[model samples]
Target: MKARIFVTLKGGVLDPQGRAIHHALEGLGFGGVNDVRAGKLIELDLADGTSDEDIDAMCRKLLANTVIENYRIEKAA
Candidate 1:
């Protein structure tokens, strides 16, 4: 089984890295980009029958910082 975790900063949080990317895009003559936000994608290979609760625990405990970030989990065969 495969699990994909998407982690991103919540709204109203400052994103220096994202800002930098946006600025660079502008410098490169790209236009019409109103905003940019950066995020993380983590892929996990797990044993079959891994419970969703266990996956949620992994996200809460170590995969994501719940205070400033939000995470979404997607399972794949």
Candidate 2:
């Protein structure tokens, strides 16, 4: 099975990199961009029959920082 994990900062957290990207976009004449948030995508290839509970555990254990970030998992067809 193939899976994808999306990890992003929770609300109210400072994102310096996102700010830099927003500034760069404005400098390049892209207007109307109110804000920017950056995140990471992780793709996984697992053995067939991998359970959702196991995948969730993976996210909790190491794929995401539970303190600052949240993660969502998607299974690929």
| Clash pairs for candidate 1 | none
Taking the tens digit of each residue's C-alpha lDDT, what string does model 2 give over 6-68?
Answer: 999999999999999999999999999999999999999999999999999999999999999
Q: In model 1, which runs have C-alpha deviations exceeding 4 angstroms? A: none
lDDT per residue (tens digit) for residues 1-77 in model 1:
99999999999999999999999999999999999999999999999999999999999999999999999999999
Residues forming the 10-long window of minimal summed lDDT in candidate 2: 68-77
Cα misplacement distance, residue 71 of candidate 1 (Å): 0.3
Clashes of 2: 0
Candidate 1, residue 53: lDDT:
99
